[model samples]
Target: MNASRKLTLAAAALALTVGGGLAVSSASAEPAAASRSLVTTTAWAKVAANGQILGGQGITGINKFGIGRYNIGTAAGLNGCALLGTINTNGGNDPGPGSSSILVGQVNGNTLFIRTATPSAAGSAAVDSDRPFSITVVCP
Candidate 1:
């Protein structure tokens, strides 16, 4: 797909995730009912440019997620940010072949994000074996 289309889908996916998360946490909100604390959390995925991911097939790498942290009060500080990230390939369209990686996530207030902006030379691969993989971030 084109660049803009990819971004749109990503955004939609994020909305669904954050929306679903609210329901799961609804049970916990009961305890804070008397405290007047309002909590909002968001999670999203970040994808490396096809070029960056494709290049670092068999290489050690460092990627970047442009993120920051925020919160409006004492009761709602960001406590945790983590990421479950990986790529997969059957080895066809793209040449880079690699597995998934779990890494620390970036913090932005109660918001969370992750991305692999940099790709370096790995041990045995030159081109990314996976064409399209996902990077997922979560926060609590």
Candidate 2:
């Protein structure tokens, strides 16, 4: 058997033994029902520099208005939600010299306005720049 399969079986055996039972069955088991609501209360998006969505959950659409300026649509209202954003370096790869910053804000109940900027060559001020970023919104 494969290593993963063996490990899974071993873990199951250990759980059964610890629970005071040692029965082995081949039938598929149904998952237990959750005790609380399963509705999603959070949304996330990973957008490329060109405004294309790489991958995410609960994202509806994305629009690029100008360099480093984007509007991301979400599947739910964000009236009282908290926003968090960060620069994404393409799967942990080095982004090279200089650093980028992100600003996230709400445009409406379900829309988010995102802006990205980097330090100017002279380090005097920040200038709008195209950079990949990820954002998450949590609603209560």
Candidate 3:
């Protein structure tokens, strides 16, 4: 089997063993459910100086968390300039009732900043390598 599938199976088996053991020893004899969650999304796009939405992405998780990525193709703009953009959960629910978002990771760019739910505040002194970026948002 593939590495990804093997890892997933191993995790499930471990959860069952631990959870099942706890329940069997107790009066209820019902396995407790695991609550740990992990979600990931990846997208690719050729962003412009003004900022634009990234296409070709996927999401997998419980809630529809707002995530975005942009490519600031120019290197002669202010680092704090705000541009119009949108965050998409790709038909998923919002992160929470009042949860906020922030930048978690970045690459192939001089600097990438995400505030609130936009990615237009990025700035770089030099040209960016323009590679695909992945974002992961954890919700309570």
Q: How many clashes in candidate 3?
A: 1
lDDT of 1 at 102: 27
Per TM-score, the best of the predicted structures is 2
List ranges where model 1 is wrong by over 4 Å.
1-41, 46-79, 90-92, 97-104, 107-132
Output the TM-score of candidate 2.
0.64
- Predicted model with the maximum lDDT: 2
- Candidate 1 on 85-131: residue-level lDDT in tens? 55444254433334333233444453323332213437543322223
Cα-based lDDT for every prediction:
0.36, 0.80, 0.34
TM-score of each: 0.29, 0.64, 0.23
- Candidate 3: residue 16 Cα off by (Å): 12
> What lDDT does model 1 reach?
0.36
Backbone clash pairs for candidate 2 read none
Residue range with the least summed lDDT across 10 consecutive positions in model 2: 22-31
What lDDT tens digits, residue by residue, belong to model 3 across residues 1-140?
Answer: 87765665566678787884322223333446766855322222222222333432222111212233342322323233322233334344333223233443332232334333322334441222222233332222
**Comparing candidate 2 with candidate 3, which one achieves the higher lDDT?**
2
RMSD of 2: 11.3
